[model samples]
Target: MKNRSVLVSGASIAGPTLAYWLSRYGFDVTVVERAPALRPGGQAVDFKGAVHRTVLERMGVYDEICRRSTGATDMVLVDAHGNERARISGDFTGGDVEILRGDLAAILYEAGAGHCAYRFGDSISTLRETEGGIEVEFENGPAGNFDLVFGADGIHSRVRRLAFGPDEHFVRHRGYYYAIAGEPPHREQSDGPRRRESYAHNDAGRLAVGSGAKAQQMYLFAAPEMHFTDEAEKRRVLTEKFTGMGWQVPEMLAELPVLDDFYLDALARVRMPSYVAGRVALVGDSAYGNTLAGFGTGLAVVGAYVLAGELAASEGEHIVAFARYDRIMRRYAKVGLGSSPGPFLAPKTTYGLWLRDRFLGSRWFGLMEKFAGDAKDDLDLSGYPAWEAR
Candidate 1:
């Protein structure tokens, strides 16, 4: 292999998965994460179709993932009176299997940690391409040069900013924002049966969902773009958007201040002509993210597999490998383009909400599910024998 040393930004799903494959293919891989440690328990993410299952099986984590899987939970849409108006099956939302984002990250991290170097609580400060390779400067650690770098750092990726351009040029806000707030760390669970159904209450442009135990809360609302400087701002924005809402919303908001795990971000999408620029390439959300579009995690895992396989197949010729990676990923990721789940989840008009409810209850919803499954399996995945033999 010509280019054996590589750096991957982000320790979440995509970065660690990429690190695992690259190291397995005999390349020296280093993963950099901004967080001090792996984040635990935010929201549930799922994998669908044969493509996702195949990649998991290849990585040898399929059995473990299944053991840790949180079987799909059905969602019920309810009115302020606490009457259920519509239901969305777990099969439709949760796909083949579902797991918490935190758990999946830990699984990928552990699988790669034995071979790949990990630097947490640090992030890339700068990137300069030299005649030999790319020189990278870190926020807290010493700088180093590497043969290649990848941005798997979500939509607002620091690596993307340094190598590509500003956020405005690539990330497009979809006029909606979503937030997830969980129970404080080590909180005791109430004595009762675990929540099997999640209830959603929507009012015009806002939606609030709460589990049976109220252990996790999710909110989605339509709004113009706004930049929040701190957690306080995010809390305030979330409160303002759903204050007048009914159902269990008031109680959910009341617990926000005490919650330790709180996340809020705009529903955005990434648009770029190519995933590669010189020696730097992007994967996962940094490449083709459409927030809550239901394909982000699946695309990220599959992209990592393809990228590492291509590099090993090409004998580490990044120019050839990156071009192939970009071409394949762009086509497979098209399903996530030009679509946003914001309006569907929290419609801006009463009629829109009614229409959504009707659609969910109609036969067409089945067809929609079939279409999604097909889109996920659209790729003709190449069997890179170099990695396969190992």
Candidate 2:
């Protein structure tokens, strides 16, 4: 067995999933998160295509994910007056299965936590690389050195900044900002088989999406990125943006302050010349995140699978593994990273909204279905051995 120690930043989907595979391959894995605990914010994330399903099955969490599936087969797009203008079916969004982002993280953490080390409420402060390994210091914990360190940390990755440069150099705003927070289910507003409804104020450039029990409200708006560090300030911005909007906007905003898992961020993508520097590497959102602009949940999971598999295949040689991961994910990630959902989800102009609704109301839905399935299968996972069997 290739015994090496690896430190992964971020406790969300990619970090834990990578930890699971690395541990299975006989590598010592430690995951560090800034949050005090597993963050249960964000909206539902879907898994599509054969590769995504195969990876989950290999990890032995496929069944559990299905059990927790949102089971939402349809989403109704409503106007200010609550008139259904368009419908997006489960066949369009969920692919095979869709689960809340937090739920998926919990499952991945459960699968890997037994074999890996998890440090919550802490973050890497500095990472200095040497010939032997990368020395890491945490914000609230002791320092340590590992054979490798991965920045699975999301778009605003500290590791990426420490290893590469500032986030501005890598993360580009795509003219949209989004927020997700839990709210008590408004069972009365449900318009589908599942208690779910998606409201869009076309003229206001606002979109609200939610599903299932103890639902999450996802709010997106077309805007230039604004800086707001305080939670109250952020909430103020959100309220102002969606103020006077119809179809549950007021209710969703009211739930923001009390929502324990409120998450807010600009919709953007991380672009890098390479995903590695010396012994340090990056995965998931830190490397190829298109934020909500793309099907990043599946992409993040697949990236972790490929990254760990490559490391094992190379017997812990980072140069070989990193290069292979980049090459494999480069082409596959373009369909997402290059395409922005800002225009489609929150169009800036009335004409843009009309055009978007036109497509959704037409045969474009079938094309979207085809695109979802085809995009999921774009990468080849055939050569890598099953992670658990390693």
Identify the candidate with maximal lDDT. 1
lDDT of 2 by residue, 137-218 (tens): 9999999989899999988899999999998898889888988777433322244225344544455477776543346677
* Alpha-carbon runs more than 4 Å astray in model 1: 184-195, 212-214
By TM-score, the best candidate is 1
**C-alpha lDDT of all candidate models, in order:** 0.89, 0.81
lDDT of 2 at 376: 73
Against the hidden reference, what TM-scores do the models get? 0.96, 0.92
Output the TM-score of candidate 2: 0.92
lDDT by residue (1-390, candidate 1, tens digit) is 788999999999999999999999999999999999998886888899999999998899988787777777789999998999999898988888888788899999999899999999999999999987999999999999999999999999998899999999999999999998875112123432122578899989999998744478889999999988999999998998898889988888888787778899999999999999999999999999999999999999999999999998888999999999999988889987867999999999999999999999899999999999999999876576446676
Give the Cα error of residue 167 in candidate 2, in Å: 0.5
**Predicted structure 1: lDDT:** 0.89
Residue 310 displacement (Å), model 2: 1.0
Alpha carbon deviation, residue 186, candidate 1 (Å): 11
Candidate 2 segments whose C-alpha is farther than 4 A from its true place: 1-3, 184-196, 209-215, 251-259, 386-388
